[model samples]
Target: MGASQAGGLPVSLKLPGIVLGVGLGGFVDGILLHQLLQWHHMLTGTDSDNIGVKYYSPYTVPGLEMNTVWDGIFHTVCWLAVLCGLALLYGRLAHNRRRAWTSRVLWGWILVGWGLFNLVEGVIDHHLLAIHHVRGGPYRLWWDLGFLLLGALLVAGGHLLQRSGEPLRPRDADDEGGLR
Candidate 1:
């Protein structure tokens, strides 16, 4: 659908924003939770009791190695998502004469994208797949819930911001090209 029907944001810009947000948000989660905080790993919950595979320990040498590899793979996927977003943005804006970059719609969609990333990842990894938790302890559920709550807030906040922005209008054929 066109921008006017899609809440005033162009698909060209919105899609890329969301893609970039997901990638950047994943980087934050991977770096902050997995690396800096040392809270959990990709397969921390993959215990033999649950899946017939030995429990993964982030402390032991072998465990750490395995987790590290998995983390690397996760990061690679995030990087690829960001690259795809960049490619989309470049392709969409390359010939456009409008200054869409400065539009609030771009940032709003980015927030929505990041929120979506958190919600999807939190639900799939933390709940459905049961591959890991936000933390390993009695309070793990609380942490996971808190993560979901934050995602919800982001989505709500982003939607509000998007709605507050002016709708993007199509550029006239005679308009000069370049950012406004």
Candidate 2:
């Protein structure tokens, strides 16, 4: 029930892993919407004709001129989250010796990361600014809200699963998996 038993590594390692996961997920959205899919950065106050049309440059928004300022902000926040998560993880590893620090289920982190991405994106895009809507129609507001809810559930469930899968104290000599 300790970090050493899991893989001779601290539970804090998991934080960087989680941050990397979240950052990757965020990058996908940024690439698709801001670069590839070309969706307007919903938070930037730019409007698209609909879901299928080509995106035009953002109109004037107060002092701001760029259309994807929101995208910039989103990327910044995502990177910051990753950094913060890493710092916390490192700090925990440095100070704590509890073997069973967290859970062994890496999948839990994956799920949590996915959930967080959806939740943050949905909130920033649909609710705070109301740039477009989930897909084009079909009650975008509720859809976005649901996405956030789904993320929360994923995070909660994943953590629970990880805790439940935790191995017992005195590392199982027969185990083969690398430090979780």
Candidate 3:
């Protein structure tokens, strides 16, 4: 038997996929929204009456700097997640690593991971903690809701697509999906 069994297959790409997806998703959020677009920062939404979060206005230079630092920290965590996911996936593949790289199952799970990231982050940061938003101001609520909606769609889409993915059969693979 294989280490990762799913319906008599050794395809266990779920964990690493989700982890990698989360990291990549965070990169998208940090780069596009935080850096390029300048929509919001880590502490932009702290102005809300959240229980214990300190507010940091992006308007002031010091506040911006603080948010930037915290953003860097967030990016670091995301980077580690990507690294960890890569390590996990790499370690799991014993044979036919090439196919695993291009597997639709992997991609599908990655999308699901990204969606999960968006959903979790949006819920905790945007709605719950009020740390930051997808886009802040009058339409911030709409943007946040859209983010969650997008997450849901990605998860659903990924699930359906992944269901169609077949397990890879390596030339030298044994029962465990590894080199014999």
Candidate 1 per-residue lDDT over residues 67-119, each given as its tens digit: 88889999998899889977877665533534666667767777888899889
- Pairwise lDDT winner, candidates 2 and 3: 3
Model 3: how far residue 93 lies from native, Å: 0.5
Instruction: Give per-residue lDDT, candidate 3, residue 26.
Output: 93
TM-score for candidate 2, please give it. Answer: 0.53
lDDT of 3 by residue, 1-180 (tens): 353432334557889988999999999999999999999999988888366778888999999999999999999989999999999888777566777877888888888999999999999999888888889779999999999999999899888777778755433424544431
Q: Residue 18 lDDT in model 3?
A: 88
Question: In candidate 2, residue 163 scores what lDDT?
Answer: 61
Q: Rate the local accuracy (lDDT) of all candidates.
A: 0.76, 0.56, 0.84
Which one wins on lDDT? 3
Worst 10 residues of 1 by lDDT: 1-10
* Count of backbone clashes, every candidate in sequence: 0, 6, 0
Model 2, range 74-111, lDDT digits (tens) per residue?
68877887687566555544333244344455456655
Candidate structures ordered by lDDT, highest first: 3, 1, 2
Regions more than 4 Å wrong, model 3: 1-8, 169-180
* Maximum-TM-score candidate: 3
